[model samples]
Structure formats: C-alpha cells, structure tokens
Target: MSAPLLAIEDLSVTVRTDEGHAQIIDRADLVLRPGSIHGVVGESGCGKSTLIKAVLGLLPRRSTIDRGRILFEGQNLLTLPRESMTREVRGRAIGFIPQDPFQALNPVFRVGDQMMELLRWHGLPGESPPSRGRIDRTTRARHRAHLISMLGAVQLADAEEALERYPHQFSGGQRQRLLIAAALACGPKVILADEPTTALDVTTQLQILKLLRDLAETFGLSMVFVTHDFGVVAQLCDTVTVMYAGQTVESGPVASVLGTALHPYARMLLACHPDRAADLAGIPGAVPSPLAPPSGCRFHPRCPEARDACAAARPATREPAAHHSVACVLHDEPATATATR
Candidate 1:
C-alpha cells in the first residue's frame, strides 16, 4: 500500500582490523511499511544487530559497508552527509532504543538535560533554544512544557522529580522509558530498537513491549526490533526475518515463518527454543565462527536434512508463497530426495 518506509538491498557489512576485514552481515534484503514492526531474530553473533546498526549509520568505528544500500524514505542513507544525517535524521528521523540504557544514557547529565540537549540540536531554534543560559523566558517555559508532556506520554509519574534525577536514579525499566520519551520527543517515524528489553526482568520486559505496542498505535511508529527471542517477535512483529551465520535464511509473515518453517536453519532455530515440543527439538552444535562459515547453506554442518548437494550449492532466497521465503533447498526437494526420504 504505502511506500516502504525502509528498504535494504543486498546489504553486506564487515569489521576492519589491522590484519584485514571480516564480513559479518551478508546480503540482507528487507522492506518495511510505515507502521509495520519487523523483527530480525537469531542467536548471538548471527549479525542481527550489525544489519540494523548499518542501516542506522551507527556502526562501530571498526565496521565498514563493503557492499549494498540502505534506503530510508527512498533516500540512500549510506551516502548521505554524516553531519546532516545525524542532525536531520539518525535520532531525529529514526529513533533508536539501544539494548542497554546504562551505556546509552549519560551519568553526568540530569535526565531532562539529556532530553533537552537532544531536542536542542535539531529543534526549531527560535521555538526552543538553550534554556539553561539566559534565553527568552517564554521560549524556556515552552521547551520545558514540551519536555514534561513527553515524559508524561511514556506514563512516567512525578515528571518534575524524574527530570531532576540522573539516569542512575531510575530503575532499568524506567531508564528505558526515559529513552523512549527522548525518542518520541524527536518526532520520529520509526524506532530501531536493538533488544530493548534484554537488560530488564521478564515482568518489566513485557511492560516495555506493551508500551512499544501502544506507542506504535498512538504515534503510527514503524519499528525494527532486533532480538534472538522468537517469542518476542511472535508478540510484537508483523513479519519475521530469521538469520543464521551472517545471512537471512528465511523471511515471511510471523505466523507463516513460525508455523510453516521450511529452511533447515529456520527449523533449527525454532528447535533451540525449550518451549517447542520434543518433536521440534534443539539444533546440535555451536554456531560456526563467521570468520569461516560452513560451506554451501552455511547451516549444512548441523542440518538434519542437509544433503551432499546442500554442501555443494548454496540455496538462494525463494518465495514459495507470496509472503513466505526460505533460503534452503528443501523447499525445492528434488523428486529423488522426496521419494527416498
């Protein structure tokens, strides 16, 4: 319907070191609409985090984009001017909820000050300038009012008191809520949350998910939630992208991906979940290092249905149904294999 809010085509990323560059994200293709929540899931080091980070232009200093494009609202983000990108976009156009608020928030600044600083950088200058140092009293009050309302939007109580307190003063969930408030204050359309609930307790994690759902509905916010937990994706995402090694092995509507998983890697991932029935069991062996992924499917080393051909030819992504895609040859099970096994 609406133009895709974000489109990532054949994205490939690598970490550069003194020795050489090692690619961690390879050939990730994704498309998201204005209000859809797309979840990218995989075990640790599966390059789930790196894919989104590359899109946000928030890659680590050692990282580099070897190939592909990140298109946001139809503009190529990879080639946008860094300073302008950060100012007009990054936090402002697309909000980010990091996995750890402890590391994202500043210990030195008061909660409200941090919000104000972010607001000031790209804020309508005449409307809201530096409020701390001798500005028009009217402008200062307006900014403060906007800030308080934002805190209230996140359902935080005692807005004034919370503002005066530093990040450490708030609980884990509270700090995350504060980050969410800051994110909303920027008037962003999409929120790129990297395992936003990983650091919180189960109860708090659920609450945060509810908050995100509510925020998405109320603000029409599209979201890219990066997580290893399929359960979270089941609850929050409209679609799921299952990654293994450094590439997406499956992508589809959440229900289709979960209920009718086809890729051996996708099936293995679901098996790893304890809640899955015994018939649907855990995958054997640790994920191979990206420095040297297994040949062919990259999952052949552990796939139950892996065939000699699987080890010889990597299956490219193919959609058997309109919304279901898998990158494993089993989908095309040759007449011989279907008859034999």
Candidate 2:
C-alpha cells in the first residue's frame, strides 16, 4: 500500500466556552491515501466537523490544538507558520468545500468575482510567483478561460453566462457545484468536504455525490468527506473512519468496516441506516458533553457491549483483520483465542 497522503495522529482540540474548556476532539487518528476518498462518519456533535477544521487551520478563535500532529505530505500542518499555511497550503495544496454553499459564497458579489479573487490570491495552480496582477488583456483572458473551464468541468450549465450572476442566481445544487469548481480551481492535491450535500434535496444530493466521485477520479485527487450518512459513505468512500464523541472508534476499508464492524458503536450506527433497519431507529441516549465526557470510552454509556473495563480506561486499538482497527475492549482477545475458548 502507498504511504498516506495525509495522516492525523492523536489529534486533540479544545474550545473555550462559557462553561470552561471543552475538549471537542480527543486523541483522534485518521489516514488518507493518495487518490482515494475517505469518509468520516458519526452522529452530530461527535466532533466530526471539528476534526476537519483542525486540518485546514480553520478552527474557531477560542479553539486550540492541545496536542498531536496533522501531517500533510511530510510536514506537520500544526507547526507550519501562519503565513506559509495561508500562502502555500490552504486553497493551494489543500482545497476546501464548505457545507453551506449559500453561506460560503458572498451574497453581495458576483460568482465570477469571488472565484477570481481566489485565483488572484493563490495564483492559478502552476504559475510561478502567482499571477497577482493582470499585466495585460491576455493574462485576464487566461484566468477567465480557466474559470469557465472549471465551471464546465463541474457540469454547471451556461458556464460562461453563469459567471456573470450572483450566488442567489443558482440553484442549491448549482451553488454546490460552484464551490466544487472553486476548490478544484487551484489544482489541489487533497479536497476536504464538510457535509457538502447535507443541504440539498435527495435527488440533488445523489447528483452531487456522483459529481464528487467523478471529479475525484478525473483529477486523481484524494478526499476526506465528512458525513453522518452510512449510505453516503457506502456509495462514495473507498475507506472510512467512525468517530464518536471525538475519538476514532473504528477505521478500515469501507467494505470491511460496513460488512463486519467490530466496534459496538459502529455496528449500532450501521443498524440505524434506513436500508438496514426494519423500522426507523436511532442510537439510544445522547452524545455526552465534551466538558465532562465519560471517564474512559466516550461511547461506553450507550454501548451495549460496554463493560467495567470500558469505563476504567480507554480501550487500546487492535486489528483482528487486516486493514481493520477498532478501539473497543470487545476485540481485546484475539479471534483465534476466543474461538478456541
């Protein structure tokens, strides 16, 4: 297997709220390989979004990376200088597709203007020193053509005329496609999408999903898609990591994780999927507050198979099958030993 393009090791993030410091992410780990799509799935408030933001250095003002490393390529993003991150990393090497396209775009600016500004800042993908100023008509024309081609790549109709319109002029799906265009405009190595399809209708959602998968393949771009839907993961991801109350509970190839989920929380999450459930169901109890999470396994309170040791200390991650790792005490014993017993 190829070395990871992006690896998040023991990342923990905290935020200062009215109550106190809340540890939103706790010792989370995830790995994304080159040219593959990895999904991060969990219930709302499980710190999925926080994990993504930490990678891009987009965390809120009060948030801090308490410890851990976000390794991209070979450097630790957490230690990168702010100027370098802004000029060399964000939008240049790593693109971002925000959740709400409506909110992501400026209501007051033309769609073309917004995208042009990005090109101006980052300079088109490969141009040395970046085309900061439009030296002549030719340079301006080049940027315009590139933007139009990008819009076209995302399948936005009337790409030329669409550039003249504002964000409000496009449909929900179209706005999403526009965001995708902007993310790909800089020719990034990796794209980070934070539930980009959550706001669209079912049909539109499916279309966006297909578009994302197609775009990734066409560009050979690696992606980290954050979503709560198992259906989306099964459809779009090559690999997946299950997060709960901040910690990663299970991770592996999507087929292995979905077919034989070792962690109890993972199984329960899969059970709640509409196709898998006989009736609509939800995991019992609510996610614990980050201010004072359960002592050991964050999911212990709701995990059916949880035992005394589960609350005593966090379970050490282990793999019973190749490429599959789970952080639950249930998998502490080797499969062969358990079977023999």
Candidate 3:
C-alpha cells in the first residue's frame, strides 16, 4: 500500500502520578495510510488520548515517552526539537480536532478573528509572515477568502455571516463543523480527531461522521480518529486499532479486525457493542489501573479466554491474516493452532 503517512511503532508513554510513574501507554502501534481514516477505539483510560498526544508531541511536561518512534513522513517526531515541532510539524503537517467544540473554540473571540489568527501563525508560506507586521488589507482579504472557502467546504451556511459570530451563537453540530474547518485550514497531511462527535446528539453525530469521511476523501487527508464506538468505526474508518488498558490488542483493516477479531479483549469489546450483544452486555471486570496493571496481558484478568500462559508474559503479536495482527496467545502454537482459524 502507500507508504504510511504516519506510523506509530512500539510507542510507550508514562506520567508521574502521586503513586510514582504510571504507564499511560504501552508499546501502542498504529499506521495511517494516505487518504484513509484509521480509527483508534478503546474504553476510557485506555490511553487513546495519550497516543494522540504522543504523536503530536503534545505530551504534558510530566509525561514521558519511554521508548518507540512516531514516524511522520519518515522523520521520528519524538526526536524533533520543540521549535521544529511547532513550526514544521504540529498544526502545519498534522492538524488536530479536539473532542469538545465548546471548549475548543475560545468563547470570547469571534470565529473570524480566531481563524485569522490561525492563518497568521500557521498559514501556508507567503500567506503568513515569520514576524508580526502591519495587518495589511491584502493579507486580511486573503485570509478571509480562505476561511470563507473552508467554511463553505464544510457546508456551514452563510459562511461570511457565520465568521462574525461568537462560538456560543452556533449549535453544537455547527461548532464541530467549524472545528473541522479550522483543522483543514492549513491543508495538513493528517488530522487527529479525538472523538469529535462524542458530545453531539445521535443525528448530529452521524452528520459529523459523514462530514469527516467526506472531508478525508475530498482533501486526500489521512485521519487518526479516536472513539469508543464500534459503530462509528464501521461507518467511517478504513482500518481500526483496538486498544485495551495501555496496550494495542488488535489492528488491521476494519473489515478483517471487526469481522473476525482474534484477540480475546477485542472479541469481548465487539461483544459489548450495542448491535452485536443480545442484551447489551458489558465486558467483565474493570480496566486495571496503569500504575499497577496486570502482570502480563493487561486484559488477562477480564478475558474469558485467559490461561496460565496469558498471565505469565505479555503476548507477542501474531498474524493470522495479511495486514492483520493481534497481540494474543490464542493465535500462537500447536496447542492453539486452530483457535484463530
């Protein structure tokens, strides 16, 4: 396939909690192909957001990437200096759409002003200057035109008028669309959307999902979409990575991974989906704390298929199908040779 627009390999992140170092992410792996939507699905506290932040080099000061590489266009993001990440990567090469629209947009600023500031700082070469200069009419007009075009592209009604309004004036869905617009403003290669539709109503959620899918296709943008919903992944993602606790349990083409999930945790997660479960069952037991997770597989305590071997050591990744990998022992050896088949 196309060289990965972004590839996260064996990424591990930790945070300094009162209890000492808490492992927030454990060797998480993900790959985003050009012009495709890759979904990162997991329950809360599973390190979904932490993975995204690690990719963007936005990990908090207390957070540390203990190992692994975040390769974007062949460059390891973890090694890039803060200045390079700010000027060359984040916002310019990779854009972000946060979970909350109400909180993402500044309440005090007009939409136009906020967008103009983005353009002023991160806009394409020649459109933005290194140092602040006179806010000339030509610059203002160019920025306004681009904003209007992006707003229109996102289907925001009366784009011109909408730009003059404050964040409060727009409905939840409209605000989300505006965030999408801003994320696309700089024409980045990839967009990291951290459950952008989680706060919207059902109908609005569907609308946002469709918009995101369409935008990815239309702009040739690869997106890493983070969400807890399998239905959303089935609808909008070309590939999916399932994370449990702080580890990635399964990853592959959405059709392959979702249709015949090999990992016990992945299977249990699928069973918990509203459409798949007969009575809307929930996964047994709770997610283990990162500070003191289970000895081996993070999900071993909750996995119905767990065995003595599973709790002995973390499972190694095995591939039963092309482009599909699962970190579970059932897919291994003569003892369980047919388990995944």
Could you give me the TM-score of model 2 versus the true structure?
Answer: 0.96
| lDDT tens digits, residue span 156-192, model 2 | 9999999999999999999999999999998899999
lDDT of each: 0.82, 0.92, 0.88
Off by over 4 Å in 3: 125-135, 335-341
lDDT of 2: 0.92
Clashing pairs in 1: none
Candidate 2 segments whose C-alpha is farther than 4 A from its true place: 129-136, 334-341
Question: What TM-score does model 3 achieve against the real structure?
Answer: 0.96
lDDT of 1 at 116: 76
Candidate 1 lDDT over 231-324, as tens digits, reads: 8988899988888888878998998988888787777678767677577566788777766677777777877787676777777678998878
Task: Tell me model 3's lDDT, rounded to 2 decimals.
Answer: 0.88
The prediction achieving the highest lDDT against the true structure is: 2
Clashing pairs in 3: none
Error of 3 at 243 (Å): 0.3
Q: Looking at candidate 3, what is the lDDT of residue 141?
A: 92
Cα lDDT, model 3, residue 330 = 83
